[model samples]
Target: MRKKHEAPLDTLNSYLPVGAYHTVMQYLGHYKVHLTITKERRSVLGDYRFAVHGKNHRISVNGNLNAFAFLITLLHELAHLIAFEKYGNRIASHGKEWKLVYGEILQQFLLLDLFPPDIANEIKTTMRSPAAGSCAEDGLIRVLRKYDRKGDVKKLVEEIDVNGLFRTDDGRIFKRGDQLRKRIRCLEIKTGKIYLFSPVYEVTPVSHP
Candidate 1:
């Protein structure tokens, strides 16, 4: 349900910081690329399409139509275009080239942070650990319970230990015995009963390197 000229560059320009508009114009001068924002289900947060005729950029806001997400999503998609234009997909997404460009634009041109303070802080924390899962422990539990049936839940009991906490890829932590109704799982504080309707991914303790 995305239109070709949905979010025109002029509208997007209004959201940019004072000097960012000029920088973006300079960066994307060659491709004749068009930026569009829509209420579509974007495969990724943003996407770049370069057909033989022209180029297009699409960002899926998913009703998070705030200026912050809009700006970041726009920058993220622009990073894709910049990467493809310069490197031609030779490197990984978010690889050295993309990261460099992202950092440069975010710091110098954008004159602001890449993400909001909380999200940026979370990213910093996530970079420290590599063994975390996609969602928070509670979120994972919720997904599991949604797919699991009644009576299939198992009870788990364990002692509270510093090592029992699970850290997510985004750096959010959940203790081993925390009661989560979404996942229908709870660890009996004394008995260490880990009750769950289904088996979710295991959370391994991170060993200090």
Candidate 2:
């Protein structure tokens, strides 16, 4: 068990960047939350686990996320922690209470100039009233995408050209096809099977033209 005043973020400096460490440290201290960074999650960017079975309240975020994304994901899960603190999980996940807490947390960063101007402005607009699904907010995504670490980054559905060959991190290759509602139709190059991929799905375009 951590000492009563132990700096929680100290345990995370290896996973978090210098720019984001201070804010997250402060948040952890305030909430007395236990944080863990696991391998990149397949389903969600972050998750919050309520205290149970004598475990300390815990929050976990993917390890590979860029700094901005890491911060927002942390805050999103932290907002859940705060919501549970105020009103147990009896309320809906994204109800008005959760929205209020989410917005409140973002407001602190905006007011403190923690983020770049563009991102801060985008967050300000989106947090006027937090959306039910954090992933569905375009303004926030636009700002966060700008900060994505640019090394051989994968393309999302919108970035993939028709007939292009794209591969996932796990090396599954697919050919971009037509759009189908919210998902884009794709053909797995090796399997020769059609699949629908989320627009936000990350993929590296392997063959162009």
Predictions in order: lDDT: 0.46, 0.75
The 10-residue segment with the lowest total lDDT in model 1: 130-139
Best-performing candidate as measured by TM-score: 2
lDDT of 1 by residue, 1-209 (tens): 54434555566566553445665666555545555555554233356565444434433332223444444455656666676668876677667676666555545533334344454444344333311222223332333233333553232222224335543333434445443553435343444655452234434333231
The C-alpha RMSD in Å for every predicted model, in order, reads 12.6, 4.8
For every model shown, the clashing-pair count is 11, 0
C-alpha RMSD in Å of predicted model 2 compared with the true structure = 4.8
Q: Residue 74, candidate 2: how far off, in angstroms?
A: 0.6
Candidate 1 to native Cα RMSD, angstroms = 12.6
Q: Write down the worst ten-residue block by lDDT for model 2.
A: 1-10
lDDT (10s digit) by residue, model 2, range 1-209: 21122224556765554566777778788887887775645656777888888777888777667676777788888998899889988888888888899999888766666678887777888787776654446567766777777774666776888888888767788888998887899998777899998777767778642
